[model samples]
Target: MTTKKETRTFNIENLNTRDGGEGESVIGGYAAVFNSPTEIGGGCFTEEIAPGAFSRAIAENSDIRALFNHDWNNVLGRTKSGTLQLSEDERGLKFEVTLPNTSLGRDLKESMQRGDINECSFGFIPTEEHWDYNVEPAKRMILEVDLFEISVVSIPAYEDTEASVIRSKEVNEQVEKRMNLIKKINTTLEAI
Candidate 1:
């Protein structure tokens, strides 16, 4: 069965350790690691890099406000590192995809395919600034990422929710017909 969208949460304890005390609370604030997002590269763009100009891409995330940057898709020449990201190296061709509908997905696809998308404002938080406590930047580890794709159409609670219900029904019918044909062939073989 296909699983629908669900909200998941994880909690970590003992982040604050008071230098010499039993339970450190002086550090203050909670630090969290998260999965980064990446999108497929369709074309070119102008992004200032350490060396020179570079391309950019974006992907959709479960969190509506959350957005992915091309850095997540870093692979062969894609980034300074020699490691491949979504290419054919890490594991398989694992890449983020936008649903058929939704404004962001629609808009993002247009940019990749046509290079005419709007300026997607995305930035990396210093980590500590977002929290109440002071924590060093670039020292956080990624824990987990919650991935999600948005569809323009809403899923039905029951009955028929899929927009391509007809397609599914047709395929099922085709399978049943193929089974009957196989049964007939087996019967003919037995009689012969």
Candidate 2:
């Protein structure tokens, strides 16, 4: 079975633009924040990216692209071309994109500078994840991912809520089972 791609968006932090050496505009910001819990699927569950989640992908030199609004046709920069650089720091996945001197690129630069666009997103396929059922809303810790692309977005598309709800139900079942086992043990001890 083929793995499905997922996208997560965060409000842009430290987003800024500067003039490039060749008179082009360059944008940089944190695309993802590490250790921050985000409620997903309308609170069906919460998710956070573990530190180093993108380490393997970046070290392997993945050819990730930078896009506008997650649209392929609106390509802004690319890792293969050295226009897009990805790295991980204490904050999260940081990116710098040298915007091309095209209409789309120019428009994006202007919009970003005007504060009309202030969100960043990344697309990936989860390679490793862990779920904590002890929390009220099950927490999903994304440990590793196959990084694909990052985008500057206006609105973020969330994961499917139905699937999240199903996962939450499964987690609840496990929690209930554990609680039942603990109760049985307590009862047995009382009978002794």
Which structure among the candidates has the greatest lDDT? Answer: 2
Off by over 4 Å in 2: 158-192
lDDT comparing candidate 2 with the true structure: 0.85
Candidate 2: TM-score? 0.82
Task: Give the alpha carbon lDDT tens digit for every residue of 99-142 in model 1.
Answer: 22345444544443453322222222111111111121111221
The CA lDDT of each predicted structure is 0.25, 0.85
lDDT of each residue in 81-173, candidate 2, tens digit only: 999999999999999999999998899999999999899988888899987655656678999999989999977663454764565576556
Q: What is the lDDT of residue 67 in candidate 2?
A: 92
Q: Count the backbone clashes (under 3 Å) in each candidate.
A: 4, 0
Q: What number of backbone clashes does candidate 1 have, counting pairs of residues 3 or more apart or in separate chains?
A: 4
- In model 1, the clashing pairs are 16-24, 17-24, 18-24, 33-143
lDDT (C-alpha) at residue 97 in model 1 = 26
TM-score of each: 0.24, 0.82
